[model samples]
Target: MNGAQDLGGMMGFGPVVPEPETLRFHADWEKRALAVTLAAGAMGVWNIDTMRHTRESLPPAEYLSASYYEIWAKALANQLLADGLVSREELREGHAQEPPRPVPRVLQAADVAKTLAAGTQYERAAEAPAAFARGATVRTKVFHPTHHTRLPRYARGKRGVVEAVRGVFVFPDTNAHRQGEHPQWLYTVRFTGPELWGEGADPGLTVSIDAWESYLEAA
Candidate 1:
């Protein structure tokens, strides 16, 4: 038969199914962990990008392996353990423990109003001219980075058009890498299937993706 059938025949044990209660509990835990992990991950990334302190004192593994919410929970737990806010035993035993520091009070209405009036806030605005106006041609750079990059591999070296100037945004690719967060003008680049995938592409379909102006070069 197939490779899977051959393997299964060799291994006498079947795929074991958990009891309904156990399965339900695992599912619930997974959901909770996912929510926490994502929040924690965002916070960790934002903290580093913004040059602010992060509660995540642990390595990247805590964020990568945990569920979205669980990542945050793990990071929080790690922070607590590191700062002596909670002990490792407490975490392992799942016990409620004191925070390392006291929670601060929320800002009052007047304070918020004053802060808003001062204009010491951050707002993302587009900063680039739509060099290639609507329907004008452009091409994404064929960039290869040894580390991480925001450009998806599929879009590299593909020809696209300036569909719409989407205004300025904080370029995560730069800021996340500790480069800088200078405003980068954004645009929606549209591509026909043939331009991206060659003759194998379906003629009727098109793909649109949001890309920063800096990511494109003249076709």
Candidate 2:
């Protein structure tokens, strides 16, 4: 899962320059690209995690070369083709070659406002008590998963203090792969800069990352 998208703390990419707050869509087509991706997603062929994995799974060169919406558009196409919602020929021809496939639901124009406002609820009731408590010292487990994982490479195998319990939620590691939601306790784990980036890192710098319980262990 280590890909070009996980650029945190990575050097040689040059510093990230800030964009103007007023800037939204770089081009008119980008807006349509987002709308199409969202509308297709509303059809429920795949979950958000699956869409994310598709985007992340893009070849390193392709992923790096694409813009934000370009990634979304490419990933959407991949999903459509994989799900049989559209054929490669149809994609190439820009027309349907087969009968329309039934989806779980359709997003109507009027429903867009409410659907976007309501959002998807991921926080589920806990099946058990949280494993770690506030202020507990813990270490992130070193893992190299073949599927999607929310745990970034930088924070792995590092020690941190629990700052907050973020409640149970769908565990993306399994959910993204269509294994199951397999929800786990979420926590805000705060790591000192030195613990992650070594002694030469800024002494005053620290990072708080939302880590699933499975990613952490008692130190």
Best by TM-score: 2
lDDT of each: 0.58, 0.92
lDDT for 69 (candidate 1): 47
Candidate 2 C-alpha lDDT tens digits along 66-137: 988999999999989888889999999999889998889999999999999999988989999999999999
Where is model 1 poorest over a 10-residue stretch in terms of lDDT? 1-10
lDDT score of model 1?
A: 0.58
TM accuracy, model 1: 0.55
Write the residue-wise lDDT of candidate 1 on 1-219 in tens digits: 011111111344457666666544355767776544433433333333322122222344443344434544555566545545469877888876654444233345456566446643233754546566777788998776533345666677889888897777766556744677766777789988888777677999888878877788888
RMSD values for the candidates in order, in angstroms, are 10.6, 1.0
Per-prediction backbone clash count: 16, 0
CA displacement after TM-score superposition, residue 188 of candidate 2 (Å): 0.7
Candidate 2 wrongly placed segments (more than 4 Å): none
Q: Score residue 132 of candidate 1 by CA lDDT.
A: 65
Model 1: C-alpha RMSD to truth? 10.6
